[model samples]
Target: MKPGPVIRIDFRGGIVSPGDLYNILVAAGRLGLRRASFGLRQQMFLEVDDSIRNALCVELDALGIDYVNNLEGFPNIVSSFPAEEIFITRSWLSEGVYKDIFDAFDFRPRLKVNISDANQSFTPMLTGNINWVAAPGSPHYWHCFIRFPKTNIIYEAPVCAYTNDLASITACLEDQLMKGEMNGDALFGHPAMAHYLWKKAEAHLELPPFNLPYYEGLNRYGNKNWLGIYTREEWLSIDFLKSICRLCLETRIGQFCITPWKSIMIKSIEDADRPRWNALLDQFRINMRHAANELNFQVEDQNPDALALKIFLLKKLNRDDIRTFGICFGIKTRPRSEVFCNILIRRRAMIRLGRWSFWYRYDICCSEEFNPNKRTAWVFSRNNPRWLLPEQLRRAIIAYYDGKSIAASQQVEQSNRQPDKTAVQQIHQCGECLSVYDDPETSFGDLPAQYQCAVCDAPKDAFVPREWEKQSA
Candidate 1:
């Protein structure tokens, strides 16, 4: 049978720990997963030294892993804006966002021109093959371009263009598609969309030029970021040497697809008694899907330029992790407005996969050092104390590890329990000599009392409270 669809994983945001890589490898072995892909983030800043690169080669060599030089999968190009503007968009925009609707249309077969100022009207550049998708919000401008083999550019000057509707947009696109000749060099928003359009041509679909399969496999199991996010989720466990194994025995589907941060396992693993590890895997999957869906939820083709702009804004805010742009260039340098058609056709290139793939090796070797905001120094700095950053997190960890609330002081605890003081009093007297105490009721040899220092085996009396300990009882 065919190897199924390609499986890709993002290493930067997902794989953060060594154990993460081990678990994924184990899972791959159990499932017979032979190929997968990994995405790298932060290409410009992270540099992989020879030693670290050698270490990576050794690890991949030992495990028999293959990789690709596909970057973070962001197509960083803008159709309507100047080349300089695209870079500005990147620097100002976060990872995954679009600048405007023109960007979305730029990826299409046509370029639209607006004539708000009569003095700055574009040289008419349209052919029977060219078309336009009128700007949805500001109809005063037309937003499409088409051309003939070698003729004066056909111009579709808008006289109060704002009233154009969907019918007009559809007509323009259809007119361009019908014409046997149009600019082939312009970039489109989604390659898939372009492919779909090309396929619309009965003959074009039948006589396609591409020969290779559309998808490629990527092996990304056993990545570090995956471990940081999920320590020992059983559904992710590897049981055998050639396949990925899962703890989801009850899953109706026998197989699953997992990325560094996301796991697409069989539906049956959702049972309540499936063990902590299995449940943990399910929870992780739940969170991953929720996050991806939320980010892409608002993305739509309508008013693409505005949508792209919103996306750009989100990326700048660090709200979205994957951004795409369509590249396009112009024939003439000046009369920026006049160059839309020629520019769209010549300067357009889609950057689906970018520097992320090339830099992944560096990312894996030292993610902590590369991610500035995540570096230990930044997190623990006086200005940004880790403990105080989020109050709920402090409480949650404490709740998980018994009632030892991180925010509560020992002295405060003693005073709060004055009403039911007997239990406190018993522990206080023994606190000094107790190397450790478990509930005094613990069976004699089940495990020694944890009341004393496990390392030095010293009596509790020898323990001096650190500043964080507050006043002694």
Candidate 2:
């Protein structure tokens, strides 16, 4: 497969029974593994020796465990498992709802799929090819966003309702894309085709406002307590894992969730069981209360080198007392790595400066709103050394968000004194699609007379100026 001795086991929506994980750990131990790692997609990963690969595979199959060795044709379905009870959600998207939705999927999606609460930032909203966000207006409906495979272009689908409808729509879309029946760009152009698909998938549409809630540490939900555990070292010891699993089973906790931050979260701890859980933690010498700054980071799984770099950067930031509140960081070690963070520290291509030695550079980029979900455009600070990333990111985060807040406040204050007349500008926009042409750089002045939108390729004539702009003209 790709010259690796690793096996990946996906737990669908990051919801795994403690007993199942314990069994997997037992199997891994038999394969001479002492530790197991969790992926950003909430999948379990274990590094095994090549000599025992066959034996391990047979044993896993016998145990009815689903796994992949060095190939990821079907990516794991990601969800906001970390937000279940810890964060505020607009609607009741319970564990049962997640389970029902996951069980309905009969086919493995070729593209990444994400089911998340729009109100929570613990799970990325737009990183998936098919992003199903919980609609705030209704508990049964979801706002769907279709991000074209291998591209940043995203198209909003009609609000989807019913678990069966979600399954059918996902299957149909995957089939259409895989069989070359329709492409992402062409899907928006053909109204009849889009109408047929919508007709087949019936749902009412209601827009939802996006809100991100901070997720970390011990939190209370109802009367019970939930604990979030993070480790600087990515690997969780098998013994510690087993102990926790036993505790979960004894306490009657049904599930254990893995977050994209490579942390484990245990929810629904009984008030009486808190002392026992704390004692177990003391016995295992596990630390749950890591600093908030240290908790929000994304690194490539199974890469010790990247982990080392992250530790180094975090230490540097801590030493400097940099304020990273409400901000998350992502380190991109591999080429073209997709990250879900406000600030990104990307590794540039290695340069062959000489035969004996090579040089590398790092690029720093931050989202316009310092929000991963609103990653419309990245403000780049290119060609920097690896060591400069921490300071560069710190400065960029402050400059971008700070300036944006100031400008926003100024606009609001000015609007309070005078009417907002900027809407009178002759800007062209698409009603059917999420495409807008307001920026002077991308306005009609810069394009040919017959130019069309890059997303839906709608003709210039299709975009009509607003009534206010028409009156002003």
Candidate 3:
């Protein structure tokens, strides 16, 4: 967004998949885009063997592309160093580690270093020989650290998850803002995160929302069916970049980057059933708005989808009337089901349900492959496989505690109200599955937390205890 003919392409490994790279080259040739850079990740380096790298090098050479390579992977060497020696050793070994990683990739293009972790003091050593992509901790104020002018340093949003700490993130943003350098930053990570960062950058720059779809339409069909959304044209515009960089500096999570080809691929996949995708999104947005109104909580701009999901989940799981609903509509993944279950458990909405609490049940089911019956409630305990994010697990637990508090309050409030004797008698006469309540003297609290379904007793955790208040008292 800043200006004319600066280096492009921070070739993150995911972006450089063989097919994707080929497409990028073909597109670049058509556009007459000369000179670009490659930023490869450690995982990507491992994934790409010699043949692919050599092939890529040949393609770039043929296209007259001069590249800057920053391939990085290390064993976290400083963790084992003595306190006094940590900084110095890190300063020295980090460059070599960068070199080692870069050397591993078979491409013979020019190499440089882009240090992701700013806390480490390795930027100075790697700066002179190669390009330095700045995050929060980079120090290259006086001179062009990578032998270029202000344009050499590539700015990116503070790393996600870790960037949640506002003080540090703000400090980083202030530094980049003060520099007033024209070069842009790579908002690397997930699509959601990338979009969040883009908005954040905009806020920092005091600009308006860049309607991305106006310039480069998304689909190959060129917006024929109102399906394609223009994204890159928006990204390439200076006004848009400035605004996004400013906004991304504030918060964490939901930031990501995807290759152009990958974006195209996703469009192709969605285009197969565009109406269905659009409808689902529209329904989700409506549900979210309704839930937010009910809860009196504003959804975060960065995570509306997640917030919407939570609202729908609360509505569905906490309902006492409905018995069964599919977690993942068309997907067959067990983890998705487990994640839904975890959300319910953490919200603390599953109280005294028939066998296995919902969370436990989901954990067990997701951990293994079992045929799910549409009409039957399947309950499980202690056998679920955990996910990669510990934070997710923690959230589930917190939600459970919160839900419990709400439920306890409701119970206490109900107890404070007195009902007419005749009305109570009429309520007690209700009989549809009364045989299941064989022990009338047992308080509802005494009922097992786990239970089978009303009709089939297929082990389930969907229903709560009913009646028996006197016994509980």
Candidate 4:
């Protein structure tokens, strides 16, 4: 929907082995798509126009890849494997558990499915239409939450399903929900129920508080180190990904886990291989450790303008040192997107009297109890101008804490404050990866006309003058 036909490649349970990923990348490179981005559902995607849509589809078809063209069809099956052995240390949930459930699926699911660890809040519990949350048990039990089709109503299953029955339960439930007017007691009456083993579910799951772990950078857990990579531009260079796949194969790493946050993580990383990863990141000019709050927001998938707005708001929040530790933000620029987050900043058409007279504003709302799993929404700010969003969101953050949010007075000053010249300096920045030329002795203009970015090989014109600007309005 965003200027080009989006090709989505589902990574079954957000798990892809190095060899399989490498092949896909090689094919994409042959098709002239040099960059790729992951989706919120832990799916890989690339933007292709009419010029090569047919060829790309053919290439994927030839490889027997599972994909959705033009963003239509059943969504990817996402799981919390990225958080296993890292964010969640004491959970019964493990990679093997997730893989077994994924492998048991005999048919393509009609509904979006999520297999998440209940102890870890990183992957979220209720994003999928049919969710199987890993609960505590010796053999492991899963709590099922079904969000009926075409409605926000989520019905928790009366009983906890056995681990072996997860796949069949989800598939059957998806089929039942698709028949329409099928919910509540009618669900338990399905003839398929006789084959599954289930126990009474807890009256309530006292889940962990919403605290997103700092997933970026090389983190140590057990004897292995894991690496999490995120890009503010929401796109990874094909070359960088290829390098990753090659490095993983050389290092004997099994697979790469894609997170619901639109990032990639490689687990079971050898300590000796840490230096190689460091070099890989350096070669790509990839920044590993962004501010924790910077990683908290989720922009609508494939929306560059929404990402730009998110960058602006994050800059303002960092400048003011606002505490957004437990909060997650979701920006919805398009209607009907089901992005899950604690605070949702939604773009709305304000006034459209005629073709020439159209205005747009934003509405900020917070989920009940600051939990994205709940659909209840409470308005924080409404009818705010585009430029005043930072100020509005600042108040919303205040509201998130202690429910004491100050009013964003419109009568307050509104102007583009000039950048701090002393604190910031102009420099040549690579457009591809945002890497700046920072040689003290030699200016960027002194470089040859044919000089490319040392990191990404972007052309000379691709290196634009980067300047800092103040928080406007």
Candidate 5:
């Protein structure tokens, strides 16, 4: 099906005033737009018919709303605004701080930049080229990680960054990188450059461990309330979105935030406005409470095939009563798409099956320690039929995590029994499929004489055992 031209409306730092949204919705309605999508970088996407394209652009311009069509020279700056009340966050990284940071940026960043709270998981901290995470124990200081262009390697700055200095520091780094004067690694290594950056941006850098928090559903935040809304249908009706915008204006909610989880979050809802929000939800027949498994998924925007597959998988998982708590999943229909999820379900490049028709296989991977940021060591599953991937991923993830827990506990018990020793154990994993052959519940010796991997159907002989040294606790 042919879709219209994409119009991107950047909500700087993921914050958009209710009045602004309402005006845009009105413009969209006038242009006969039925639906809109939210981007991972907290921007709005609308497909406009060519006939009304110029008219819509004129309207948006008159309203002073910044928008671009089919061009992405500048990427929207992402932040943890959506995670404020819905997810656990540091006290100092409040809405005011976020707004101040967004306002301080005088120049648009060509590279992706993410400003997130290290304690929260709703927003990815490492996906941005210039990643800034709020430093623990330092109120307004941020830890910066610069990901070199076209590379996965991340380099940390020598010191923490002040909120006011973020824009200038980022601009300087980008200029230096683009000019080929220094790389991320060399920027920190060169004494002169290091001294210059430190002098220009004064602060001490202390990077903390990142933990992704579970973010879903209607949650209370002090006297105020916050709501997280999701839909399996992929697109929310324009009418419904407009209604919510009107409600926000009426309740003086000020702004709405879009989460990376492909959902809408409205924070600072007054206790008195609870009934109004409830009435709006009831009128639209919206269900705020979805299973955690259903809520923690990311699908590529505007991809119907991927969205359909996600719905299918979620249904199957729910039917099987699988416990997928504390995990997030992403389905990428396009190759090399940057989506933040603990587990990834990727579609293999389409293979020509005759001339007119093509066939596709799926590969699945779980991030190290279930962290999306550390995707360097991806253990992939063999290619499988598209329809069978749901069950395969479910089994693979459960077994992987379960075996990991058991291995940890076994090491702990062994260490207690023999205080002065370490144990090395051997296990097999397929090099092609990356499926581990070790499971505490299943013994390799008990397998049939000729057994193959359940995932890729590779021969048992293909499995190679590798030893891992487990230290005594």
Candidate 6:
């Protein structure tokens, strides 16, 4: 969509108070905005009529609302709270823990951050510059990983950050990076965040492989119910939002969560209130159950071309019954913006067709070993036209399975060995840790000379082609 008079409201940690959201909705509804959207970072996206843009701004100001006009600067803190109860796991991480961490922040952060469960594939682990992942510890700990600004270099810190120190460490890191202290590996010893550090952090966090849960529709959670809402167009009606907010207020539901998937989850709906929720959905003709594949897409916020391309590719994939069960697709038309996906479609260059028309060529890449949490993306095909995406993406998927099969194969034989034709695939493994370069198609000679185990940071020569068996959904 074309940019107009726009304002973005940050809902820190994807957690929103019902009343706060309701008030904003009322303000927007009164100002002629019947539609809105949520961003991948869990912020609210609003477009005001150019003539009354300032008027909306005035109303927000009176209501003590803070908003920005563009995608640059002031990144929101992202957390896996949306998946907390729905994808519940036995861990020290709890709702109170999340709330405490949020409360510890004395000031808004200037950097993107992710506080996510290490075992959950529903939320990304490395999409932020400052990532505090759930780690094993008695006092509760988070493994801090930092991605340097304007660069692809992501590194591990020397110490794990205690829960109480997350805020101080975050603010300190932001301050230091602002002063051109871009060394991620050295940040642990910085005086600003030194004392807050605890035990030495593990060199790598072996995350669960990508497997997105079906996060839509009314679902049973204990005695209560949680309803997840998503719109294919992503343009949610203000009336719909307000209706849900009102229900939440009436039912005494304290809060709701907006996900990085650009959807909302309203939890703790009483069983008695189920009919009311169903009636509300019926009244608005909302369908919460979307096809599994339809729910796995991430488009650049409010990008028409990206959405269009998504629609086109989906049609082809569905028609062919393409299997994309374990993968997430991210479409990017904007340069240098982070996306959470196993398969990435990026706009490389545009070709002008007329004074007002143009066509874009794309580049395709996938995460290392098809692991969505890794920041590393290995290029497959580049400079592909729009029409070639479905085919190219299918081939990439095929490559993933082929590599997977090869990795499950037995160890290479002594002479001119090929991967064993067993049920498993065999790939390269690091001598120091469990990290493996699981791409069998890519020759060893073609691997980057400086490439090392992302987990152990062992030299490239430390990796040898090997076989292993692992099971996943």
lDDT of 3: 0.28
lDDT tens per residue, model 4, 1-473: 24467898999888999989998999999989899999898999888978988898998898889888866587888888888889887777777878888899877787889888877888878878898887665357887887766555677877888988888888778878888844756786688887899888767565666888998898889998999999888899999999999999999999999998899999999889999999999999998788899899887778886888889888899899999988899888765667778898877654446543247677777776677777534556666798999899988787777642322333243243443444445767676545556555557788768665433345789878877643432
The stretch of ten residues in a row with the least summed lDDT in candidate 1 is: 358-367
Is 4 or 5 the stronger prediction by TM-score? 4
The TM-score of candidate 3 is 0.20
**lDDT (10s digit) by residue, model 2, range 1-473:** 12257888888888899999888888878778888778888888888888988888988898898888863557889998667767755457877788889998887788788988756666887888778887655665676777766455667764354554677667766666565533554653444334333322245333232333444456678999987777778778888888889999998998999887777889999888889878887897877667777777787777776677788888988898887766777777665457677777766544445443246677666654565675524435655787777778778767856866887898777755744444445556654333455444344666667554333335667666654443211
Displacement of residue 86 (Cα, Å) in model 5 is 3.9
Per-model TM-score versus the true fold: 0.21, 0.81, 0.20, 0.82, 0.81, 0.85
TM-score-wise, the better of 3 and 6 is 6
The TM-score-based order of candidates, best leading, equals 6, 4, 5, 2, 1, 3
Candidate 6 per-residue C-alpha lDDT over 371-450 given as tens digits, one digit per residue, 9 for 90 to 100: 77775455677557878878998898788788777866633533456445445566776665434554446666687786
Alpha-carbon shift of residue 202 in model 3 (angstroms): 15
Give stretches of model 6 more than 4 Å off.
137-139, 350-357, 410-473
Error of 3 at 419 (Å): 34
| lDDT winner between candidates 5 and 6 | 6
Give the range of the ten consecutive residues with the poorest summed lDDT in model 6: 410-419
Give lDDT per model, in order: 0.25, 0.71, 0.28, 0.80, 0.74, 0.80
Q: Go through the candidates in order and give the clash count of each.
A: 76, 0, 39, 0, 3, 11
Pick the winner on lDDT between candidates 2 and 6. Answer: 6
TM-score of 5: 0.81
RMSD of 1: 28.0
Better lDDT candidate (1, 6): 6
